[model samples]
Target: MRAPCERSERHRSVARRRWISRASWACLMAACLGGAAPPFVSSVSFAQQPGARQAPPPAVVVEKIEVQQVSNPAQFTGRVEAIEAVDIRARVTGFLHSVDFKDGQAVKAGDTLFEIEPDQLNALVASARAQVARADATRISAERSLARNRDLLARRTVSQATVDEVQAAFDVASADVQVAQAALDTAELNLSYAHITAPISGSIGRATFTTGNLVGPDSGSLARIVSLDTVRVAFAVTEGLLVTIRQQQASGGGLDPNTLKLSLRLANGTDYGTPGRIEFIENEIDPQTGTVAARAVFPNPRHILLPGQFVTLYVQEKDAPSLPVVPQTAVLQDREGRFVYLLGKDNIVSQQRIHTGARVGNGWAVTKGLDGGEQVVVEGIQRLAQGMTVQPSQGQPVGGGT
Candidate 1:
């Protein structure tokens, strides 16, 4: 009874409506089972559930602060100096004949360092000897004359005035002989100067004058010698620090120069294995720099330290008092001040402000705001909040057991 074209159109519309209904049912089932609520159900479900709590404070490594005896060393820039340094120079004018020692060689006292031409000096010595011989002959003749005159005067053969004149001539001859002897001694001394010798035992620098060069007393220096067995390190400290040291000494908290320990760090950041002692302190403080100069002596048996080398001098007071110290990593700074997270009785982290002093090895010396026997958070400090509860575990204190 219906037309065939109209029936075909109705069948296609019914099939499309059924397919859409099945797709909507599958989506709803996937959302509910996968724990993903549909947009319309999300707000309703959240309202029905209880409120969520914050995550537990992160687990942190904590350690109890302990007091220990530590030397709070102070570091200052310094320079190495030789115990004895000398500039080798020629004492006479002559042509340089030879250099006895090689450049940068170790030398002992009385070692020949240079040789100057001695031909002229030898001629002078011969001339002086001839003069001495002439003066000696004159003295002999004058003495004989005086003796004969004295005998004649006793025998009444000569007058008193003639004997007196002969005695005066003998005295003049004797004086001439003495003067010639002195001249000969001076010539010999000049000859000795031609062969220059080392004045002290030390390492020698390069020679400034070579063979064939005219060397003289006015020549600045032929070479340099520096004693390296023991070296001195000179450094300057602030006046304020000096005052504090004196005050500590008065209170028995500081050490004397003999008892203090010193160490050096080379420019390349390597430690000098040998230890040194503070041997000298300047008598007056430098007014312009507001500093006091101090010096320490170190034994350099192998000649490891060289003069004029820059280094760092570390001064440590022996027998220093014990103080509360914490790992440097535990300390933190902010707008307020430097502080550390302390774990109290209930495992609550509290930010405790601290006044820090010099570094004691890898730890910080606490000057104030902290007593011994308090847990300090070292690992989880970054995540910590004031008054936050945390689970703390014991860990080794920093600086390897300190």
Candidate 2:
């Protein structure tokens, strides 16, 4: 190699000649194109470089906005309740002789739940019977005495006052007999109560009092039974929602609450397949809560729903407004709020700000921003930027409704 400075000078001279040639070529190209540089010359300077490759636009999957019929369901936390709930309490005082049913047992109306030992109750019944028999014996004797006394008076052998006195004695005995029979009837009724039976078909809870435990009417409750074949769900609605249920429509006083459709999501998040109908709405809102009570009846043949179970209740109105819907994948969110990339004319994508409402099936109900006919990018959004051009293809989102 020659001296270092001379070698560097020769290299600089060659680079300057190349630079001048490139500048002259760029000027000639600019002149040929109009009097200004090409559009990409400033922002994408490499486009003017010789042999540079152009990139293809990114591909994106898009879904068209669809008009979806929705029910606009109102959601609230609810509780599972039996239409008929009864606490099992012994009507007559006695020792619990036998627990007739197992804990958590399914029972029908008139099913024997427990048997209270009827030692004292039976004694009372026997005593009542004895008193009634004695009253009958006394009444018979008094009537015979009165008849003989009246016969003596008819023969003029006795005074009328004596016969009248005997008659009064007979009346007193008859009254005693009637009182005794009434007591016996009450005793029999009490005996029947000793055999505690379910008043309604339902699932029975655990037995509170076991064998040898003295239970009576005053005893809190021996157990509880709740009806299962047809259950009810109780939920509270806000003042606004209460109005919606009672007066959703202007005419006809409002939508009939009986016509409102109801459904439930259990605590475990599984949906109860059976639908329910609104059965009751309170006459007034609760003064303390400002919420009104409402109930829906559901057919629970399987007894899967239990009383006091917390659930998520959904009440749907039939005359819901049609809404613009889009697949969830098309939505993008940042600090500025939610937006979707709209596939506009000539494959250009622009950001569309949207006000989203409730989710409808697998998609979102678009409350605002988009009409029902526009297309939006649902996939390949990672590489997207504002005003970008993309290769758009249709995305698949199937059937709707829940």
Candidate 3:
């Protein structure tokens, strides 16, 4: 009975130990419920399914803004002309006469250009002179007869009627002499008109009337002569341009007549060596073309710039300080206005509005906005936006606008 009792005691003790062990296990599990995920599972799971890394925005090349001094030149187109030009014509009527000047020859004022046969003219002059001699002899005879009759009447040897008749004869002879003198003058004038002379000193054009071609007062133009030593160029300018010109002139910006420099480029691109000055400005504007005619005078010693030749003109305005310039690519235009992309201190791009002037070598002149040393975005401008970041690269110089 003692042994059985001891066995029952041992079983109870084991049962108690089992119950404590189960209670401790439950407490540990409850504590673990308040804790984070296990280290092994958390770390391993994250390593197997990590999220993708985002790519950085593409870097865009940019440029630095700068100020530069440049020349301001205005270009225009013009035409060449002759200083003076006139059509040659005969002043007297006659049979086909001799042309004294060769085609395209240079002639001086009063130079004989053509001549009519003088035989008929010379005969008229001789006949007029003979008439004058005969009239003078008749007048002398009438005067002697009138004196004899007067003496006879005074001596009562002749009647009063005879004396009156002698006086009338003398008067008629005097009238005849006066008419002969007038005829002689007319004949001399006709002789002079037979010779056609140049009215001006200039280059003569191709002769329209040949040596045997009839030339006279009614024969019309024989040829033309154009004076080219000093030539004039006529150009048309718009009303707006005229206003600008007037303002420039009023501002004391006009070139002196002696200092006015002008150059020409022909349609074929040949340069005219001679220089010129502005001569005249037309008062009226052409209603159809909406422009006024302006004239320029050029030194044409070589006569290379012929009249009526089309050409391009260049006029130099007042010299000014160099202007700020930028590449054309940097400039952008929209409904708002013209602007450029510039890199900021944060290495980001920002749009800046600007005023532009005439084109410089390969770029445009910045009239306003933007100081020196700012990075300007030239390339990749299309990809840039306001406040966008960019990578900048030094670019080629913006030379004169092409």
Candidate 4:
């Protein structure tokens, strides 16, 4: 029952609102799609920029490889030994009268060390001398009697038997004289033994027997003396090392064990001022140890090296011929082996495997795998990779340079 014109106007208004809502939805979808599409496109463009133009490689410090003479030293641990060690002992039976030297005093050869009771020995010597005189007088008297008997026999004043008897008596007296002379010499020798003297010139240890103490051949060492002006160092070298040394000598490498120079480091970690030379090598290898015994002589003018002290011995070899060398910092080890980074043309880093020898100063002696005149990376190695570009700068030369 409503008006027809009002109903028609309401329907038209509903259609217009629906059309505006559809149009607004389409515009919102288009805006969201446009914003999302730009970021995807921009990401692709940004990645492509790096591909077109690469960044410069990381910077590193490098040194040119050079060959130089290097020294190889073999080291060993050894013990210091005295050139001469003597023990003082009494050679005869006597009561020690006095000690002539202080404890631990240095003494020269023939220095009096102790004096035993000489009273009894002196009396024996005197008694032997008196007996010798008595024997001589008796022999003279017997000889005179024999001569008188012989003259009497020629003149027929005495019987031939009496002459024979006198001659026999003279012979007996001569034999007695010889016995007395032997006894005197024995007594004199015994007296000499009563005074103990140092047999060598060296520092002596404490005396085991004091004044008034009984010391004789039965007693042990009275004291000990060790010569320190020249000392010896003894060390054992393995059979393998001994073989190597022999091989070097046979090859005419100019390594003579007798003339090899040596140096020592004391237990206190100080270098001995004087150098030494190899003196003796045992003729036979020790069966128990399978090593050869070697000794070196060192002049210990100041007596700094004492017996039983431990020290380190260094044997320097002749300078090896010049060889390729590189900074130790440039040497790297991995599962493969020892390798170093070499900067080649186009500033590209490549791994170079190397055979390293003895350390020469702060660098390594490269025996193989690297020729001379190659640039080796010394710094910033951790940032390096195979075939990676690098910015190399000149650094200190390795192995003292060319």
Q: Which candidate is the best by TM-score?
A: 4
Error of 3 at 353 (Å): 5.8
Q: Estimate every model's Cα lDDT from 0 to 1.
A: 0.89, 0.87, 0.80, 0.89
Clashes of each: 0, 0, 14, 0
lDDT of 4: 0.89
Cα RMSD, model 3: 11.8
Which portions of model 1 miss their true places by more than 4 Å? 1-58, 64-69, 243-254, 329-357, 366-375, 380-389, 393-396, 400-402
Work out how many backbone clashes candidate 4 has.
0
Which pairs, if any, clash in model 2? none
- Deviation in Å, model 2, residue 180 alpha carbon: 1.7
Q: Please, what are the lDDT tens digits per residue for candidate 1 over residues 1-402?
A: 569888998999999999999999999898778876565487876765555555676899998887777676788999999989999988889999999989999999999999999999999999999989999999999999999999999999999999999999999999999999999999999999999999989999999999999999999999999999999999998999989988998999876676777888898889999999887878789989999898889999999899999999888766676778888889999998999999987889999999987677778888898887999999988888999999999989766322
Name the candidate, 2 or 4, with the larger lDDT value: 4
Candidate 3 lDDT tens digits, 256-298? 6455456778787787887778888899888898889999888
* Ten-residue stretch with the least lDDT total in model 4: 253-262
Tell me the deviation in Å of residue 366 in model 3: 1.8
Residue 350 lDDT, candidate 4, scale 0-100: 98
